[model samples]
Target: MKKIRAALLGATGAVGQRYINMLDRHPFITLEVLMGGESAGKKYGQAVHWLFPDAIPERFAEAQVRTARPESAEGCDVVFSALPSEVASEIEQDFAKAGFTLVSEASSHRMDPDVPLMIPEINPGHLELLEAQKKARGWKGAIATTPNCTVTGLAIVMTPLLDNFAAEKAIVTTMQALSGAGYPGVPSLAITENVIPYIKNEEEKVAKEAKKILGAVKGGAIVPHELPIGISCNRVPVIDGHTETLYAEFPKAVKPDQVARVLERFSGLPQKLRLPTAPERPIIVRRENDRPQPRLDRMSGSVPGMSVVVGRVRNGIDERSLQLTLLSHNTIRGAAGTAILTAELMQKEGYIG
Candidate 1:
């Protein structure tokens, strides 16, 4: 099989660095172009702050960073965007208009009626919306987005429960990591010893995006699931993982054991198709009371940082309610990693060649 040529936009940010690490020796995609804002003319190594503990990949060390314009991505088949939402909105569309499949981490297009805000394991069917998106926008290529870092874990955990027990309402409270705020994020003075109770628009994104991700595709549009999701987001002192506590109400009575069994047995399109980046198990159920901690379980799957760690499953406020805690690597499973998985899914579904 010929490798798909890909480009990375915002190549100097935290999420962009992860994209670089992930694509270093990717099985199906090759990193051919590196684009950034102010770092456009410098070598990638010189421009990037290099956040990861691992050294920069030699392949991209000397690569010249180009400006984040569609024309700079001329030879790419796919464009993986880590660009900020403010700038990504226009630039991503430009790439799609130029006929490049775009998998974006920015929030710009996640809720667009035609765009598919995807978690491959939970909503592969939603990819069909890409067709409607292209036709509506008159673009040759289409845009697909991964949800906010906080929503990714919540949606993935809720998927199996929703399927097995018809969960209709959810209340999620998140203790998100500092990384989710991006590089040089949250001032040291504010988040050093305290928990900032608010993140601009994060609560809204989780509430709306989850329903859309869990929604059905019909008549060329996505009808968001009728389920009610309420969320409370907070920025914590942790460095890498986002931890969420979820309370869900099911239509019928459910036992904690039953919920665990369903989650343990759950697998979706990505798992069935054996996509290269798919985790062997999308959710890992832990029985210990204090499990799923950010430091211990954030990277808990066969594919590290690809699985959501779920623990402390128990009865909620009533017999019809179920509650559990989940942890996921925000930058990996939530942003860059999920974007890569979406691209792999697009390739498998023949949306990208």
Candidate 2:
């Protein structure tokens, strides 16, 4: 098998390093370059100060770390972008226009009509827009983004119900992990034992991105649903997963067991393609009362290295809603893992050669 040559745009950052560990053993991917900003030209061993100790590969030591230049990643089959949002717009756009497939973890172009905000299990069909993106921009490649960490879990649980019971209104309050803010994020003083009530742009992301992911595809464009999505976001002291408290109004009644079975068996596009990084079961529901705790379920055996774990499901009567708590590895499932899964799906669908 010919391995796909790949490059990592922010190879030294937290999520970028996860991309390194994942692609290192990926049977279909070959890491060709490790790019960074100020850290460019540093040894990979030194560039990444903290890692799994065993996850960093010896082969990466010789890989040159350079600031992203169009010509640097010119020949790669795909580029996994972990660049900070501040600089991602220009860098990612240039790569896409230069004919390199760009799978990103940034919100820069997520709302762009041409760019697909995808969660493979819920909306794999959204990949169809990649063609339109490429042609509309006269580029050789395209871009795709994962929903915000909080949005990933919300959409996973809501998808089945929308199809079955028809979700009408979604009210979500998220306790997000500090890591969601990125490296050297949130000061220890501010979060050691605190729960700050603000995460700029997060609430809006959950509201809008959720609708887009659940929206129907029509005439080669995404038509977002008019469902009411009310979201509240907060930054917590946890290191890994972001947990959400949700109250979803359903158009019809649903049994608790019915909802449980749906989540247990839920598998969509990524599952069918068997994408290398795709989680076998997109939504894993825990029967135990306190099962999907951050430290415990964030990186469970089922989706090792993938982000997300959901639990605490219950049905409501008068409210006509279902309530649950959701947890996902903010950087993994919510960012890098999803990007890798997207790349693998693109590879399987022949979007990448």
Candidate 3:
């Protein structure tokens, strides 16, 4: 595989910084251009409110942040947009219209009819939509998006359940981390020692994005899975990882051991292709009753923070139902890591150079 040059759209923000951290020594992709809004003219290190404990890699720290525009990304093989949703809508479109292929972590285009809302493991074939996306949108480039942070782990867990045990409906309750809100997120007065019961739009985004991601690509578009989903989202005091408790109904009786076996063995295209960012095991099932805690299990994987960890697999009220708890790193698996995996998949599948 040839080395690819990549540009980032929101280089000074939280998710953008995660891209820098993860891409610092990427096998093929190189972060050549850094773009930002108010921080556009300053060097990345100087402008960012750098969140991670580790220092920002020196190269990216010194890289000057460019204004978010298509020309700012000239010569780059791909553009990764980590911009906020409201602003990402316009700027990302401008880049696509200008011929820059984009892999974004923004919510603006996730539900678009032609655009792919991807979880590479769950729907690699969805990338096929990019071709029609380019044609229908009348642009040389196309956008491929990732699911909402809250949806990533839940959807990953649901995939095997639905396929193996024929799970018919899901009831989910999430205790999300503060980092999911981005830097300086959830004010001290608002979130300290508090569990905010609501995060506007999170529940809906989770259900819709999960369905689309788990959907099958048909007729040059995706036919979303029609699984019934009931979700209750809440913001917790944790700093990373979103934890969700899921209760699912299946068509027939299924055993906890069977569900554990299926989930623990799940893997997809990225794994088969041996993509650099692909986790050795996308799902890790724990047996202990008090397992999959956010602090301990969020980063549990060969590829750290990339796997969804499940525990407490058991029966629900009836023999035809199942229950489990899941945890995933909100900023990593949920944001930057998945986007990078999508980029790697794109490169492998010849969607990008």
RMSD of each: 0.9, 1.6, 0.8
Candidate 2 per-residue lDDT, tens place, 1-353, comes to 45689898999888887888777788888888889998887877777765566746888866678878878886899998888888999999899888888888888888887788888888878889999988888988788887777788778778887887788888888888877887888999999888999899888888888889888778778898788989889898888788888788876776777887887777788777767777787778888998788888888745684635667778865546788887777788888888887877877878886
Candidate ordering by TM-score (highest first):
3, 1, 2
All candidates in order of lDDT, best leading: 3, 1, 2
lDDT of 3: 0.93
What's the lDDT for candidate 2? 0.81
**Considering TM-score, which of the candidate structures 1 and 2 is the better prediction for this target?**
1
Poorest 10 consecutive residues by lDDT, candidate 2: 301-310
1-353 in candidate 1: lDDT tens per residue? Answer: 56799999999998999899888989889999999999999999999999988899987989999988889999888899999999999999889988888999998998889999999998898999988898999999999999999999999988888888999899989999999989999999999999999999899888899889999998888899988888899999999999999999988899999899888888888899898899999999999999989999988888789999999999998889999999999999999889899999888888887
TM-score of each: 0.98, 0.95, 0.99
Cα misplacement distance, residue 273 of candidate 1 (Å) = 1.0
Q: After superposition, how far is residue 98 of candidate 1 from its true place, in Å?
A: 1.4
Question: What range of 10 consecutive residues in model 3 has the weakest lDDT sum?
Answer: 213-222
What C-alpha lDDT, on a 0 to 100 scale, does residue 287 get in candidate 1? 99
Local accuracy by lDDT, each model:
0.91, 0.81, 0.93
- Among the numbered candidates, top lDDT falls to 3
